[model samples]
Target: MGSDSKQVSKIPKIDLSGLHPSVAGGERWEAAKAEVAAALFSHGCFEAYFPSSSDELREAMFGSALPEMFALPLETKRRLKSDDVYHGYIGQIPHMAYESIAFDDPVSPTAVEEFTKLMWPEGNSSFCKTVEAFAKALHELVEIVQMMIVESLGVEKHYDSLVSSTTYAVRLSEYGVPLNQDTKIALDPHKDPNLVTVVCQSKIDGLEVQTFDGDWVNVDPSPNSLTVMVGQAFQAWSNMRVRAPYHRVRVLGKEKRFSAIFFSRPSHNSMVKSPEELGDEDHPLLFKPFSYTEFVKFLYSEEGRKAKNPFNAYFRIGNEEAA
Candidate 1:
């Protein structure tokens, strides 16, 4: 019964076996065990470690390429402003949530200022290579997890085939000041509005996740391991059997921490839903069907409407196809 508490101090890890085969190396196997069924109603978090030997390659792929990609001058980054493609780059996005907390409620003025002055700086050739490699490695890991979920549902021999046409985006973020926050650096508390987030970090810590009891749990970085959690779509598909947890970052201490996050998203045009085993008449559909592009646009809109956050709106529950 090795648990998440046994592994790291402040970080919480949802052991996958809680959702898969609970009996380790046991021969008694059902289509999907009872524990797996119950886990669908509980937390969907897990921890994984990559060997240090692979760290160099992972960093080169995910860590390095990000700044290199973002540093191509304002004009160059703007040129890649992920228009309808929804797959390229977002030059400079304003920090809409926490800005108001520090200044006012409609928080985009000074927030945008800080983001412009700070945030991602320049991209380097060597860094881009490392970040890209890490992204690819993490992508493979997500695919593996998806396949297992498909099997657990007792359907779709190849789960990936269902999501083959999807486009997945990964972001490598560096937050706070370089060991100095009183000067010019700060990030707000906001949950990622995506399907799943796999995060890997350096020595510095800043991540916190909400647990079932409505308490914040800190996620510290392991030397070579990445932390993975379920997102909104997965929750919707399961009719909320799987819930998307809330998370935020707090600027602690003063060491500049580098984190590589691979954001796994459905294709802009794909519709997400749960397996027959997980959905029912009661849970029905809970969200409207919309393209990832539309979802993002709505999220960034000034209308100030509260729709489903990225992490809570997956496998929609409405007849959006007719609309």
Candidate 2:
């Protein structure tokens, strides 16, 4: 998805180990918040070091749930379907050796339970528990980052209203080594359509993100860290003040790779609009308020997927319109 021919830099790694809202006015918390804001706006992503997320969670996730779930038969995985676009099992692509399955609203008991039942007809309670707990941890981290971004933009008052209508989807992706020798692009470079995305990568490092200067970055996430990305929805919400990065997975080693990505989005029916504080004389509004659901439908369309600047085509306001 990216060219390593250009200089490869490490994506910004921030230690948000003990962040809390109570310290919002403190220098330490504000410093961390500013770093996060800078990384999101320029690099479009940051590797977060959150100690509260324990090693056991990562072990259980990568050790059992991911391997076991991906081992299931193709037919079994196919049974995990969804009415929503791109929310279900995705596999059988022409070139990519990748397959993924997701549970919408992973934090919801009913949602995870339903997905578990489908994946394991007899009911795999362990998977359900692990998914729920892990998702919750990631959700908390997402909230911290969101709050920081809101505060940085001086729209902290809008935080509660914004998150009140948020929904989440978590997906586990598996990429196997290819038969050929050369490195292969396991996943295409694309920006997610949601507001925020937090990725839990395996010990193996292969994900690459593009920087504002066009350098490709190799992200190596420690057990304590997860890669957090600002998505296209955030671009509209922040009036293009924050960029949604372009990232892709590349596979070279023989070992299989697995990653769990959690997406925080506005509820499907809700509108995504920039806050009043975000639009000003210098930073004009770049998008009209858009429907979270309809925009997803557009990205899944043939035209949307093919465009290099999908948001520019689908939601971005032109210069004249902005003026």
Candidate 3:
């Protein structure tokens, strides 16, 4: 709730309990959609109060399942491998305490089962069930958030295809930190390149998002709420109408931090493009249509990191002569 800059406005909070179609009236849904659009454009992130994220669900994930998974031998955890970036086990770096494993299509039962079985070769049905249930619940929130973004942008016509063309991934991370008095920066500041990133953090205050005014704000979310963030691909898809906040995790308190991050991105073969109407006089074509897969390649490449404006440098519509 408190940001470094006292002048910075608090991050917007949206109630998404109106998940059931008939439960929420047309007017209320529309208002929520508008709020989502405004928040993304303004802060590039918001805290969502989703009542469905019960305490039991949170405990199953943060309390036991994740802890046990991380407790596995390093070799056992590394068994879940992948060729894709950040999709497999990543940790045990020289000095960093961060460790993570991501599962694609986490909403599907298969992905969850595969990961669980890999860690527990013989069998571990409980972990599989908990992960599947948690991811499925989170997926519902992601779907509606994406829908709200598209609808608020006046591109509701493309919503169906957009949904179909998306692939989801969930990354679970745990940070190892000593109980030192000094604050430690666990991760550097960076914006996600996907469409949207929704994160559920264990009850530790660490995640921070930068405000438009160049100030960082702590995202202290409630147990029943998930913090949703806009990402670069969505910024481009919305013709730069939505901004992605640069965020990082800091170990303010002397405690290890754990987080579950859910990402919804375009399928590997799908393209990321904004509606022609989005490129009006005020917002001339800032970026061109580019492949999400290729962009991701550049995102993790040396050139991408060196470039000050990676997305624009990679696919901007104008400035052919600048190069």
Candidate 4:
């Protein structure tokens, strides 16, 4: 339950076999259900190992050209500016704007190449085909995991129905050097704005998560593996049963760190209503139906600017205005 150096192993691996209702009723279903329940109730996070091929496809996303792309001078990267959508290169978003989500002193862009702005990298049509295929691959996997989560909760229907088409985003985060400051400059503690984030970190280790008993655990990058995190939207739909874990990227050492985060979110107008069975007197109607676009703008505003944890703002746990 806690992440002491000795107890890090206690973090349970997500049981993928339970992707269907029957999976939870089998001999080991109870154990699987308990594991997921504990993860939801405790740390608000869990790790599921994707196949090696998945990792390979993800690696392909960060093509040989990506390095050069991210390596592009900041001036060039700015050319692909995203207006309201923070899709393009983010220069140096202040700590306050993303305080609830990113903990670094000042969130700065590490790298952005010519191709980083596209949904998928550009090359020949063959490469475009592969990119589309890759997106489907990842989407199917997320669906499987989502169903299992629904089954585990003993809900009447799969949670997928509540979601429309999912919106997936991939970002190549380059945490550049501290710019001569004596103190270490890196991202701060925060939760993601999407539904679920599947992060593929480079060899460099700096990502950390808060444990149930209040200890920081380093979530290292494994060869061809993903670090899965639940996000604000998912937590909102789950009605506080599942939580969005608090995490941050700390750029240790002097070298720049490259991390590729594959963000999976539901469509903008998708409604996040309370699960039928989960609606009770205690839980009640905690969240009104909100579009992800609106949530994004809200997050861009003051309510989203106060804390290092996005879940705090999204869930209105402590903010009186949101309440």
Worst 10 residues of 4 by lDDT: 98-107
- Over 1-323, each residue of candidate 2 has an lDDT whose tens digit, in order, gives 44664244567889997776545667778899999998887778999998766889888899899999999999999998788888789988877788999768888889899889998989998988999988888888888898998988889889988999898899999998754346566787788888899999888877888876666777876878889999888878988778888888777687999998898999968998888888889976666778988898888899987866667778654442211
Q: What TM-score does model 3 achieve against the real structure?
A: 0.91
For candidate 2, the TM-score is 0.93
- Candidate 1: where are CA atoms >4 Å away? 1-41, 58-79, 84-125, 178-185, 285-290, 303-323
Clashes of each: 32, 0, 0, 14
Error of 3 at 91 (Å): 0.8
Best by TM-score: 2
Model 3 lDDT tens row, 25-138: 387788888888888888899999987778898888888889989999999988887767667999877666789988798888887888888999888987888888888888
Worst 10 residues of 2 by lDDT: 314-323
Provide C-alpha RMSD values for all models, in order: 10.0, 2.6, 3.4, 6.8
State the RMSD for candidate 3. 3.4
Each candidate structure's TM-score, on Cα atoms with residue i matched to residue i, is: 0.65, 0.93, 0.91, 0.73
The ten-residue window of minimal lDDT in model 3 covers 1-10
Indicate the TM-score of model 4: 0.73
